[model samples]
Target chain A: MIQDMKPEDIIGDYKETLLDLYGSICRVVLYTDIETPYPDGKLIVSTTDKNGIITHVNKSFVEMSGYTEAELINAPHSILRHPDMPPAAFKDLWDTVNRGEKWQGFVKNLRKDGGYYWVKATVIPNIRHGEVVSYTSVRRKPSRTKVDECIKLYPTLF
Target chain B: MSYLFTVSPDFTPVHLSGWYIFNTWLQRQSGSPIHLEMYNDFPTQRLAIHNDQVDLIFANPFDAAMLVREKGFLPLVKAAGVSDEAIIAVRADSAVEDVAHLSPGITVAVTEDPDVTMMGMIMLEAGDLNAGNVETTIFDTYVLVAKNLLNDSADVGIFLAEAYDDLSSIVKKQLKILVRSQISVIHHSLMVGPKLADRRDEIQALLLSMAEDDKGKDILKSLGFDNWVKVDDEDMEFMIDLMEALAT
Candidate 1:
């Protein structure tokens, strides 16, 4: 009989194996039917081309934003942009991502309901053949402390 | 010249010696010229490694894990045995006395690097402290956080213990340690990309042999190290536990 491993043990081994492989990669999955144990957070998965145009946003993105996938598709990923965000931030983000470098920052995004949410986002370039391809992003609700920091900095940047 | 990239917690002249020593050792062993660059922050260093900007870096444990998981970088050696301790600090006269007293309305300053700040947050979350009432400020470095606290801009500050050693006596005197976290597993690890992984045996051999040379000892002393050790997964499991707990 194959013995079942505890979730903690599996997570431990998986993290170490990944560390041994990639130095700074954070694996974040966006879609799921089961509820996540972490409270007050949602995962957003978005794919964009080399120029940062939106190509796909999963069901979770549509559900969380209250926007249809049809509306989101082909739109710039920043369509749901919150007014509080500074353009300089996105400029830095694009500069980094286009270079095929992953950038992590706290972002405030607006939902269709006009309410806003904060995410700790990791944006990475999906590379193929040493050429920049799509950009994949995984975002989760950041700690409230981190969120507050972003809120405080947003007004100054704008 | 072959490029050598390294990420350190900071760019102080004291911390550059390790990379210089390692680079010299690599040059002597492989007969290749090396040019080295070092970054102070974890995120920037990680980005450099991913983009192939740096060939190797001294990474924080979590950053090392992320690189191995996401970018295919190999953890080659545990550079410098120094383990950093994180501490929660407040003004000596502040009303907040314990972990429970940290609420949302209170302002806390943290360094911009997630590795250090997140570890402190994980400990607070595990203790069930009220997070909603806290206002957090993220500065570029602990020195900045210290400046903010001294200027009365923040109610609390989280900093590494070693940072205190670098501060002026007057500034250190104004601060009081509210709590020091349980010993966290953090190390400055040397990591190499896949291109250099094939040289693992040679790399390891050079690192092991460096301590015997007079020039190598100078480099080691400058980096704040007496020796290096071969650390395995078991050595880093505590950090993994902290990351999983924080992720939840």
Candidate 2:
């Protein structure tokens, strides 16, 4: 359900919580022009339950997200899901993964510092005993060209 | 009317035929026309459950929460004296003798079993590994997870203890178990949705008494169980709460 709502509508309460957690200096709920550079030769990885709650995060993921291990654990993955991303794109992603397929795309992720980072993400369903219990998402640095194409394409989708 | 029955997808590949055999026996015992449909993945099976297509299911501990709480599935039976656990293993020759010796940027292979993965990841903390420092690859089967380790595709592997035990001796020889979880309360259970609520007691009785007969004993062996036992609602609830706690 949170997937369909706009960021402004969803982050209002969340923003207040962040403000309380880190005081006014914490601007995680706000969008900014800053871009967190994806480290070269490193992959950011995380796993989530079927509902998209973060179950595990690699160090690269922690560094890129700007959130401590405690804050990110059990948090909805949508915390990093950027508003600039068209809802349709996410809808497509959900549909594909739910169908037990891998989904590949460039994502604009919101960091805890309010900056954003682009990633070439591959989400694969981990199926055991013929059932998908969770998802493992492996993300790497997206090429500048692909990021640019998504920046143009996502707007049209909106 | 006829009803639908299914099992969790994570059953050992060797037991593929056992489910069919049991389904046939169930039809005879219940005196009803029940169709068995085995879903290959959780999403499709969950969709089936969501659409009310499944009347009976033998579900894992994680999926049991949804069945009992969301879908009104009642606990019928669970395997006797069995609990699900996770084991962390590495290639026997790998230099990382202890989990603490492992470092960042290591690739960890795993499957979709949530309870196992949750336990596996928790165990990795000894080595200071988390999602951000280690790369994770999700394989479709435990055999693939073993293959990934054998071929040196992954530095470490998280396996369901049962699956790890089922691996060929040659594969097990090349690998060394780093750790195994001993949480003994959690396990899979056979449950019946609201549609089959009326037959709940009868089915439970049938399952619990299966060991009394030779044929039933054979079926039990095929499914990798000694016998079926009644599940205490409170114990199931506790496991569900534990799963929720671990997942977060």
Candidate 3:
């Protein structure tokens, strides 16, 4: 009897199912945070097109980078790139992301005041029909040992 | 009497001969024929234990550690001798002369299994090498990693002790050992399920007493055994420390 529903009704039921799935995923996200005390410290989530123009920045990113959403949304992600970072690092990162493999690394980005901070970042390429639609990144504070090691090496790589 | 064993493609003929000797020894000691069933992999052996098909097993140290921690099994004796020598090999022509010289952009090839790869990571941690900077590529086999290094497909390769004998010649001629770790002993152990805890003393006595027999001596010699020693809780503590350290 449920299968005999009208198309509109079926679509509405499908929407509800999707909303339930999304809600379940959100619950999982909340559970993970509760389980670990070392919550992901901060995140700078941004979407970029093929040409690397920034399409979005979450509020956390705006606050962390010391930029408003308006100043960042249309800007290139390189606006925050640290001068001490070697071009080869970004080149390799882009190459990995473009190939649709997730790239993970400790990156140093310059804040608006020219001071720098490090993040352990994972970049995932979003694709549709073999074409990359955008890139998304999740970042968090790395261990102090990790940050210290990268800080000592980053200047030499330039 | 029922016994369990694991068989792998990598098992040498001598390993098979050891099993025969074990079976003969068990029969002589118990005054009855023991039925032996071999599992081809650790997963199957684990399942057999879960299903109550096997009472005892020879498991890899890592697997045995998991079984002990997760299933509360008691380890009886260590079978395979332990060694802590992992090699980080770089091509003869490469610029990396030491672990400190290993640059960020250079690719380091490692074996795919985390059990094997963790040895390299441990060495890296000890050497204060930052893994975040190095490009790490994982191969299914250490030999394949060596081949990749020889072929210039990767800049560095890490090989465990088992792979050393096969890779040494190539390494000496075409590659250099940038780092050699201190020998850390990691033994493969014979384990018994929780059901056999009551019989622990008898089982330990049986294993320790085997060395007194001529047949046991022959089996031990053939299997490269020195002698079976009593295992204590202290012996297992290292494994616990290693597992905890690696988990982080």
Q: List all candidate RMSDs to the true structure.
A: 15.1, 13.3, 19.0
Candidate 2 per-residue lDDT over residues A26-131, each given as its tens digit: 2234666678766543457777889888988878888888778887889777778666777677778789989998787789998766678998777877665478
Instruction: List lDDT for all candidates, in order.
Output: 0.62, 0.79, 0.59
Give one digit per residue, the lDDT tens place, for model 3 in B1-248: 55554432223344677776676776677554556666655466667767766556665555655666667777677653544346777888888675655555677798644445555654554334457766789776677888899899888787765665555574568878766654344455666666666766777788877778787787777666756766665466445434433433
Residues B54-135, candidate 1, lDDT per residue (tens digit)? 6666666657656666666666667555665667778777786665556657788887555556656644542344346578
True-contact fraction per candidate equals 0.00, 0.00, 0.00
Cα deviation of A66, candidate 1, in Å: 53
Q: Residue A145, candidate 1: how far off, in angstroms?
A: 19
Model 1 DockQ class: incorrect
Residue A98, candidate 1: alpha-carbon lDDT: 75
Q: Name the DockQ score for candidate 3.
A: 0.01
* Model 1, position B162: C-alpha lDDT score: 74
Error of 3 at A8 (Å): 91
